[model samples]
Target chain A: MTRLAVAGVGAISPAGVGVSTLAEATTLGRCVAAGPISETNVAVLKKIRRSAAITLYAATAVEEALRDCGVSGFADCALISGVTNGALNFSADFHHTLVTEAKETASPTLFSESVLNAPAGNASIIFNIRGPVYSIIGGQSIAIKALMLAATLIETRRAQRAIVVCAEERNELSSFCYSRFNPKAARVFSEGAGALLIEPVDERRPINPVELCTITGYAAYTIPGSPHLALQRAIDGALSMADLEAADIGVAVSDYKTATLFREIPTLSFSDCLGYAFCVSTMWNIILAAMACGGGCPVNPLFAAGLKKYAKHSEINHVIIYAAEEDGDASAIILSRVGASS
Target chain B: MGIITSHGVGVEANWEKIKAGESSVGEITTFDASPYRGRLGAEIRCDTSAPVSHLRAGRLDRASHLLICAVREALGVAGLIKPGIDVFLSLGTTLGGMLSGEAFHREVIEKGISRARISKTLDYLAHYQAVNLFKEFALTGDYTVFSDACASSANAIGHAFGLIASGRYDVAIAGGYDTMSEFTFAGFNSLMAITPEICRPFDKNRTGLVLGEGVGILILEELDHAMRRNARVYCEITGYGVASDAYHMTSPDPDGKGAANAMAMALKDSGFPDIGYINAHGTATKYNDLMEARAITKVFSSGNNGGVDIPVSSIKPMIGHLLGAAGAVEAILSIMALVEGWLPPNINYVTPDPDCNLNIVTVGREAKIRALLSNSFGFGGSNAALIFGECR
Candidate 1:
């Protein structure tokens, strides 16, 4: 089993540009409405002006994460980005132009960014991550898969470190489709980007450092089976990988309604305030989980209160993050505070 | 392993056509191609009479149809159609259901938004193909969808190889597929990436690449598991390496360092002094062929046999470039070549450029190759190389 260290975290969410802003907003029990990242906020990267929102969000979050980690360059770092619709706005525009207008009128720039891997490719170009870059497409669980791939890459010595980013950009087409399918949940549509810097765990590194959280295990399961059963299996697999038990998990982070599974543990839902930004939801959960384990405030006040209430009496060493999609896909990862006993 | 290409709907069919040096590129029939500059493509000739048996059978897009058929063939060959097995699925695609999405959008434009179906719109997402497979086969294990342009499926296969090599899963069904769509065709045409005539890889007069549609699937099983079940072992995936150029979004590095690094990484991981054959990612584009040739020469210049005679060829001229499915299909063809002692030719090779100075296989050559390398580079500067060795 390869143990990976969460070295840094960054997010571009409804709360604003930084993770601290998100955490502060959650602490104050405020929900920032989802909107596009302003042009001024991303003007630092002038090249991004011609790029799509997904690329902009990813570049911003990745830059912040690199700075937060105090890393000067990422020449040897691998990138694994999870995207749901990629650049949907650009694609819709290009497609609409092709269908309604003349085929020759399709913007070449938009077509280039329309591909699903464009964001990951642009991120690699902008961040100077020359190592292997992979673009995974799925719903919420894709972020967990990205983390798993990152850990695997590090364990196999493919790279010394990895940057995993998940970004989503909401568009009218997507909003309309979702509303048509499930009107009740359409109001919660939002857009954001989240990133994590993970490196292999080293015994010589300082323990319990402020910039460290250890990801001990990860598990993913699909369905044709029951959703509950899939979730249980994933959780059990993660626990076994971590060599821990259900009772050992002190704080749980998930967008799923997991009250039945973790009845006694403090469960935090980042999506409660951030809305269901499918690609960013799970990564946000990981960030929030790390914060909770590090004794920092979360973006949700109720979750913050839960963390405080649980930590006052217990050590809150182990935090398990769970993410499930309506399609019956589930993923779980176990993170422990540095210096915590296995 | 199983494959379905424009040549036909089976591995043997494609191999036969490939051995005959027959080109599958023809006029596009899926849609009206009159408006596009490059009207030629390798489209799958689907039989409308025999339909796939599923709830959304008829509504499935070309990509999904190709994938489902290929998976069925792969599972049949591997004899693992039953459920309750821990078989992971990793699929790669570029367009997914864009054809269906385009049709739906056109309907929305003509009729109204209320008439557009949510299901059709949902199909546009790249992961929907994987979801369809999950439901179709009742796959309960982990699944991933890769959309890294032309390198997508190769990355999927590489990930599967890693998972099995790491002993995470005993079996994995991995491959890639994409269909010819007007969206992609127009995009490539607009970018002038599509060749108006036949694709000619490594040819001095080659213009560009020809888009194709097909699917390839491989059922990768652990050595012990396959032996216990007495399964047919095609070849062992010995090594995989992926890297980025970090240069340009669409163009490759001129010096070919990025591509060479990926090949070197794969070679190092495999610990193979020399490979018997190489399936080059010769996309027929001027820059791609030149860079790939340089990369190949740079990595294999000091060959184990004291000569840089590693026979290399690209099957793109025969089957056209399948984009996302190119890697997986070419990989399958490479494995077939290894087993059958046949070196697939780079058809339509007339004049060779001085830059691509390596030995190019112009005709079918019989050689018993122990190991082979397949390279796939895509639009995002993503590059992946895989080495397959004779399992015996």
Candidate 2:
């Protein structure tokens, strides 16, 4: 069982920048679009960002995460990011300008920022990170793939610490694709970014008593037509790896309807607050779950027909975050409060 | 191994073309390219996978079509079809489904955004192509897509190796795929990175790279699991390393520090036994080839003149730069070199400079290679190096 410690977390959500804004969104049940917030800041710093909003949002979130963790400069660190469409507006607009106008009139800057991994690349450039930098695109499981790769990097000793970022930028083509593919789940799509700083939990040394949280277990897989079965398998694998049971979990942050499989355990979610920002939604869920463990504040989670409110808590030592899609994509992660467990 | 490049549709066909030193680059016919300065590209004239498929070839993007055929060929050859064996899919792509995106954008440009057919744009997203792969084949395993420009597939394969090493999954499929798009063509042309002259690498008068498209995929199964099932193993993947330059988004660090670190790390990860050949990421650009030479000299210094004089070669001159798919394409070619006892020739070479002081394989050579190293660099300072050898 490989475990990684969460050192710090950052957010650039609809409410504002900072994890406090994410917590406030849960308290107020708010989901807003904060594209211009990151765009303005990133564009003021660099000219290329004006053409690419995803890079701007990702850099803004990564900056907060680096600062939150007290990491000013990079030495032996890696950056891994996840995105849904990766500056979709630029790609769409570039193609529009190329075909409508002459091919020679194409803007070089727009074409440079239109690639899929521009967000990760821009973040590495802004932060001066010299380690392994890459981005993952996992449809609805983008966050899952990013975190999984971070674990791989740490386990293989590729980097001592890693910053995992997941961002989304909404455009007309994105909205159209969402409406056509999964109409029921695509209620309201927004734009934002979520980041987490993770490091290897050194078991050789004494355990840090005040450690915020440790990712005990994680699993990602797919099932052809069985959505519920997919969710169950991921949760089962994660729990088994974490050496815990479903009943041992105090709370569960989930977005899938099949997550109801774990009944009567104070189930809740932050989608109402973060909206359906694809990968960002899952990243926010994980961050909020970490905050609830040791941040000295009880995050007020939003409830729905399936997603429940912050009901009575028993111990709140272990929180499991689960997300799934009807297209058979399911991923689950278990977070253990080190202070509480000790 | 499975591949669908301009040279051919399968591994054997591509290997024969590459082994014969036949360049596949020609004039672009899929779309009008006469307006651009660099009208030449490695476009596939005979697309067997796209023009006919059970996947409704008309609706799918060319990238998706290539990926579908490649995956089918790989899985079928490995006998993991139908009731698919439990496996993990790790894929890589840069401008995925950009041609489909152009089609949708053309509709938007001509009519209006609201009038554009939503179904036509469904495969425009990178993840949509991955999802279509799952739906087309009766695959049941999860997947992760890497998008680190030209190094996308190298990073994907590296992460897949880590998964197997950690005992998480027994079987994994790793590779990359891309299709020629006018958007990318114009972008490269706007940067003047595309050479109007013949595509060449590591030459004094070499112009630049010629953009191409294709898919290169390999199935990675655990040694014990494969032996238990009596699987036919071609070669073994020893190790891989990933690094970022962080100097420039469009260009690499002139000093080649990051590239050197990636190569050193990969060699270190593989225990540094002995390297026989290096498949260089020698893009014909003036800056790229020079930086790569400096990077190679930084790692394997030849001042002592007693080191393992390794031979270095670049296949880009023959196949054109496949961008995201270049890593896996080169990896597949390298493994063939290791197993088939023949090295793929780096054709179109004219002269060399004193700066790039290394053994450059100008023509095809036959040798019993013990181990091979392949490198890939991307537009955004992304760098990766992979090592392969016979099954240990």
Candidate 3:
């Protein structure tokens, strides 16, 4: 079996910003109705004015991620951040601000923070991570894909461990981009971030130490359904490769944008509570999956996420399943439990 | 590795034409060129008005057009365009459908949200390009869209190779595609990287680089996967190296430390005694030419931990330059050279610069090439090198 483990996780999500708050929110089924936060004067150096969403939430998640991973800083770790827009908060607004009113006093620090890998850069700057730092953006798959890449780096022994960070702001551009597709669901517009600390599942570590059950496989489909058949093929292929039957599978994470698609399966959507934060759904599912490992009591549909069916699958040491939808598209991954005496 | 390029579309056809030293860079036929100064590019000659099936799903931009065409041809050439195979798609592009934004700008100014926002739904936006292409190609496996400027495709191909090498994906389709757009043309022009006339790489009189258009893709499969199906293998992607200049966003360091490190790493990773031919990333820019020459010199002088010096050349001179797709296209040229014993020439290397003192195969030569190294450096100090060798 592939030896993989979740070393740490970071998120700048809607669940109050940090891991502790997010975990509390998830455990208590807390829901916070919020709106887009604007960083109008975000560029000042001594004045890093962030939307309440950014400071209150993202900061908390990042701290918890570092703390969990025993990463005091970026002192000697290879940091790979999945960042979509660099200093976008600064750059995106810079042009508009300059063109509209020419505010030379606007914060350049905010502009600097707009670098694509800001979160990783921030973590690096905060912790002094001095190894290879890379930032990549692939729509919503950023977090899951980053996890896979971190695994590759560890498996190759490129670095002892890789800190994977996925942070997104509730910027107007993101909301505008998403609202273009699902115009009717404008209220679904929410913002947050998520991150993970991945390291090699060392043999020296305790066996069954919260290991990665398995990442069945991933498939990407186009927006208009060119990959319907391809998606099924990937699912069947991964199942076959694992020498398991489709029915034998228990939990799955689907990148579902809407709840109607879960027509007849036990489904849970962290998106309902977190809102549509693009990549946040994928990272949030990590926590959901971890929580479900203890046989999550059927998802309560009290949450307006349209989760009517409790299509729970049979459990055979498999506790978590997840799926995330990106721009009317999705990628699903299934993770099982790593405990012994299964 | 499978071949799919704009020279003639497929491996056999491209190989045949490239052997004759023919130039396909010509007038832009995809769109009107009245507004632009340079209207030349090697566009894929394919009828895109086919069935609206898996291949034409989500990409509604020019870059997507190039990618879909290249991917279809590549999978067909590799005989891996069938069911039961996990198709992993990776593509690289410098400017993705920015032309669409130009259109959106006009629409927003003239028409308004009904038109401007409608255009935003198109996948040409940099962030959505890869997502749309994956959807269009119906590739439902591991994939990534690299945007590391010029080295984007090389970095992408390297990643795909690793996926296959690590026994993750059985078949990986990796390459790059870019279209001639006003945004990139103006941007590069603003940077003063574009030459007024034909780009003369490694020459004293060379002014700057010329931006070109095209898409090139390769199909990488596991050695056992290839042999088990009796499929023909062009070459094994032996060495892949990546580094960053960490210097300037646009200029390469004068000494070429980053470029040299990339070359040394590629050779070392391939574990080859000597690189038969190197498909140089000859952009012809002042700093790039000198830095690449310095890099080649350092690699040759060091002897690769005890190996011999190698021959190198750049096809960018003949085809202009494919920007984000240059590395993927040149890599195809390198792989083809190893397969057919043909080295593409650096057509416009008349006045050689003393700084660039390497065997550039100025007029294009032929030899039994067993291994080939392809170099690609991009803006933002990103550099990547790939080595392809015959499957042992």
Candidate 4:
């Protein structure tokens, strides 16, 4: 399989907007953990009609990515989004109106905004991207799925470029859901959006030859009662496909559930810096990995030590991002910068 | 193939009803529909609980029931319900267990927040609905759920096809499932997109779409793999093309450019195969049917793309719009029509609108359908076209 070029990256996290804030998360420390996004930071998001906070985050992040990519026209690009749940905030509001108030009072616009693919749709409309646009929802692997789908689109020539975005909005319904799904967990539910622009690379290009951001391997599986095994299998599959051993892995962005799965490899906890956002946090992990693959690895001492070896001479890079559920749902993906065979 | 639609519980029955050319829409009985202006829905009147064995069907949401029943039938048809069977499950839905969401909301509105039921929140998320299917069949594999409104399942099927084509997975079960819930019903009604009378696609006096609920599943296996297993081959998925209108949220592009592009792309993707028939997305809405007709004409007209005038029809008139499930179910019906060499009628179609310049299937007729196209246009400007051909 051919590698895909990481044209651009964008994110709107608790610390602030842009990928720079994400790169400085360790140094600046956490500013705000979790809450509703302030309008001042995302004032232009309202241009998209009848948008909820999730759509706002998504559209804003996508706009930043498009701007960062410096591409004026991406009319033929496809948009894929990874969402934890559709905009529960708007859905609950509509439901509340339907129940408390009359069903007649339920706003159709609000109802429209609640669907899972609303963000992708709104972004497509706002950006004039008439190409393929859809949403991916299944636990945490959606980020990997989104990236895989994007790479496939580019590889198959389905689209010249693909925009991969992920967003999660927290509300009362999410709070209730969190309590029900993971009652034992105490981390505050964080929320944000992330986007990446992926394009095909020229095979015969010179200069660095293989110094492009590329997703080398990805795997998804579910193994009941042996979630650890599922995680291990996913890692093994990704590593096997990428043809890299565990020793070559520079750094891993992992949740507590996946931290121990990386036995000897150095791991960075997502919650340590940005709290626990759902799909957006996963996208952030990929963005950091993408940066590292492009030889701009974050300088955090914890991740730097383990990642520095791969950064030396910048020849052949491998980084892993993993997520799992207690019920056996697990997914793993590896990104690398290929200069030579390791 | 497995299906449970307004017509009945099996593919043959559903196909028979479509061929019989009768409107199956009825007054909404599952919930009080008097509040909404359009009180009609193509509800599943049959016994949904009879098809369950793994989970307590009666205790589950109607979405789970429909999906599980359809999947059970699909597994049976595929001869893979036994041991050592592993296939990826990919599904699409506009609303997956929104009834569960309504239930949770009602509980919150009734009792205090502290007493809100936990069971109501189980299948509330769309992803959990897929997990429920895994639990029902005791199946364990990575699954993807696409929630792109109506095109949800079509996209799912296309994704699975891509993976299989890329040698990632050999066999995959893909489809769409949605249960008619008052939440969506009221929203459509509120938007004045639901019609009180029977849906009349391509008709001069078409009002709007009528909602329906059901599940449609198909086992997609590689040709060599299926041949090795000696599996029953239904039809070959030739091409799939997806596009977004980026025009309006509810309405399609006024000129049908997105829809036309999707159709043209599908035809091109299939190497410009001779498309003998088209299963239109025709939602029976004022905007959809006209736009679809123009789109079809734009692709298949004599003046455009060296294409021929293909026979087109909308099955929504007979079974009502299943929303997300419409893609898979309609594709299944298209496959049946292809193999059976029979064309389903576009029921309740009256005087044809002059704006729609094309051959509209007004009655069931015998035709040699070698290849066909199934179109599904979803909310938020999502458009997908799938091409299926006879297995030669």
**lDDT, candidate 3, at A308:** 31
Stretches of candidate 4 exceeding 4 Å from the true structure: A39-43, A203-212, A256-260, A297-302, A305-316, A338-341, B50-59, B81-85, B304-308
Question: 2 or 4, which is superior by DockQ?
Answer: 2
State the displacement of the C-alpha of residue A171, model 3, in Å, after optimal TM-score superposition.
Answer: 5.4
Model 4, TM vs. native: 0.95
Segments of candidate 3 deviating more than 4 angstroms? A14-18, A21-68, A71-139, A169-177, A184-187, A203-268, A287-321, A324-330, A333-342, B1-59, B117-120, B125-142, B204-206, B245-265, B302-309, B350-357
What are the C-alpha RMSDs, in order, of all predicted structures? 2.2, 2.8, 6.5, 2.7
| Candidate 1 runs further than 4 Å off | A39-44, A203-209, A296-304, A307-313, B48-54, B303-307
Q: For model 1, how does the per-residue alpha-carbon lDDT over B1-392 read when each residue is reduced to its tens digit?
A: 88888898888989988877888889999888888777899887855222455437866766677787888888889997566787789888887888888887777777778887667877778898888787777777989989888999999999998899899999999999888888898888888888888898889998999988889999999999899988889888988888899888888887888788889999998986359999999999999999998888888986664335889899998888998899999999999999999999999899988878878899998998999999999987988899999996
Across A1-342, the per-residue lDDT of candidate 1 in tens digits comes to 766788888888888888887677666767867666553245536866788888888887887777777666787799999998788889878878887888876777888888988888888887778888999998888899899989888888888899999999888777888877777664577787898888877731353346457898789998754677788889999999998988888878887775699877877776667777886988888887777666554533445467675655356778899887777788899999877776
Local accuracy of candidate 4 as per-residue lDDT tens digits, B1-392: 99999899999898888888977799999788887878898989998864655565655777887887898788899886554556688899887888888888888888966788767776777877687777667776678889989999888888888778888778888999888888899889878899988798889999999998899999899899988888899999989898889987777887898989888888888888888889999998899888888888877888754333788899987787888898999999999999999998888888878888778888899999889999999888999999999998
Error of 3 at B217 (Å): 1.6
**Candidate 1 interface RMSD value:** 1.2
Candidate structures ordered by DockQ, highest first? 1, 2, 4, 3
- B90-149: candidate 3 lDDT, tens digit per residue: 777765665565555445455655555654445544556666655565545556666667
List runs of model 2 lying over 4 Å from the truth: A31-51, A180-186, A203-211, A298-312, A340-342, B50-55, B81-84, B304-308
Across B149-236, the per-residue lDDT of candidate 2 in tens digits comes to: 9999998898888888778788888999888888888888988889998887888888888988888999998888888888889888
